[model samples]
Target: MKTTIAVLGAGSWGSVLASVLVQNGHQVRLWTRHPQQAAELNNQHTNQHYMGDYQYPPQLQTLTNLAAVLKNAEVVLFTVPTPAIRSVAEQVVPILHAQKACPLIVHASKGLEQQTHLRISEILTATIPAPYRQEIVALSGPSHAEEVARKDITLITAASTSLAAAQQVQRLFMNNYFRVYTNTDLIGVELGAAFKNVIALGAGALHGLGYGDDAKAALMTRGLAEISRLGVALGAQPLTFIGLSGVGDLIVTCTSIHSRNWRAGNQLGQGKKLTAVIKDMGMVIEGIKTCQSAYELARAQNIDMPITEAIYHVLYEQADIKQEITALMQREGKSESY
Candidate 1:
């Protein structure tokens, strides 16, 4: 009953997921691009950079070489950021041939590829061989890495083409404190996962501006509107965005102090520049890239996402935040039902 999992990316989320797998009695091969970091994990059982204070199970093996890990891994879990996915995929495509028989690919990362506008599962499908593509699945939710790392009760969704794929992840990842749910709506889950970060930044910025609950609630509600609008354009079910991966994730990311996107936006709202906020965070703030991509996507699809548009302009076009807010409030009134 022990699943062998190869988890790529050594960031907080990746390490926490690996730790969870180890707790679930799975043999985990934690992979990072840096061999020295892998050596540290193998020898010290701690990721000094990310999960510094947390101790991992002694049974967890750490490796830098993707081939070595993927060779025997029953499931390959991607924990890298969206931007790094292509290069990582290119590096692993050759060895992936060996996994053609019955491979299970699980993408734990969120965010769509900016250039291709493809989701994580889409990237896996395009890059991985045909046999492995069919097995590509995504695990996402409102669960924060920090909370989940502490063994807090967390819920997530594992979505794939096959119902069996979802069940596989549920079995591999579910622990006493971590619960996994299955969904076949891969498009909705992935899009919801990606867009929530952008909305979180907006929500955080609003919070930093000393907005009241009514304003925050409006931002949150309207943010879901934008997510639903664009998600539907891209083939997601309208109702899916209202589920855990959508509204649930938006609420958590926007309100929680643990959210990197929200934190980054807070500093931005407090008048610090983008570069400075990122420098202080010292980790990937996915919303910055997501804002850029989502803006581009909206324009390409002819979707009207005003909040997304406002944030995009403020971040990229040097538009005044106050003016953008006023513009949003003054937009032509229409029936609430869309």
Candidate 2:
């Protein structure tokens, strides 16, 4: 059966997922805020900035009109950066309402809103109007856009309070190379996805600071513990942190050179200023903002996320990376178990 999926952003992940849907025999309409970029994607069949060499499927269409993009769409996948979700949701709802259409809303974005510190789905649920509220689902995992663009084997979890909604996305995105699992723990999945980017920055910083695999491994392991701790504090199932959206995501984001958060951390560890790092990397490094939100959330909830705190300090207060890492290492030792 063919489905019509409206992808709300044309960045790396959005473009790749749109192409994947096209592979699954669906009509995918991808929208970008830039009209010129829309023309480039549709005419050139490539998103040069985000996806370098990967060509888009011809079946995929690019458009600038939001109303047209959402018209008759069965699914709307939000792939924009976290900061943009609220405004986009606010803008798109009236269009959907005008059409009298209700579609499953799936978000692949991973980050907490800055002040509210809400998860991506939480923001969506709050912003999206009531009639379409239960249709929200979160799609998250270790899958990288670059790898998925090449059709590499990738696994992800689709989570919703409504299992039926999660399974709908599971079936929509599943294929031989792309595997999708359904989960009801939306918080764990979204938190795991958001927190790992912070850890990946730590992992990358460790590497950039001339540390060995041992250092990276330790950071990753401890990072997962803290993520699980915070996830549990937020009312997510503890075991969800061990699943694909948790440990699986942590491993990939922390280790992969393809991770923007890791790359940003690497640059910062190499003694680049935060301003320079942000300017040089022409992408939305979610971990930077996510670190702020996570730190705020931890303080508010009395959760101990030491690693996130250290990373947040480095990114925000210009704390020396070496000093932060050293402080982390010298902190009073505790039991290894989360």
lDDT of each: 0.86, 0.90
Model 2 residue 318 distance off true place after TM-score fit, in angstroms:
1.2
Badly placed stretches (over 4 Å) of model 1 are: 98-102, 132-134
Per residue, candidate 2 scores C-alpha lDDT tens digits across 1-338 of 88998999999999999999999999899989998889888888989999986889887899999999988999999999999999999998899889888888999999999888888888888888778544789999988999998889999999999999999999998999999999999888999999889999999898889999999899998999999988899899999999999999999999998999999999988888989988999999999999888898889889888999999888889789899888988999788884
lDDT of 2: 0.90
TM-score of each: 0.96, 0.98
Query: Distance from true position, residue 223, model 2, in Å?
Result: 0.6
lDDT of 1 by residue, 1-338 (tens): 98888898888899889888988888888888888888888788888777667887888888887888887678888899989887887777777776443368888898988787889888888887776544778899998888897888898899887999899888888778999999988999999999999988888888887887898898999899889999999998888888889998899999999999999878877778887888999998888888888899999999888899899988888777778889999999967664
Measured on C-alpha atoms, candidate 1 has an lDDT of 0.86
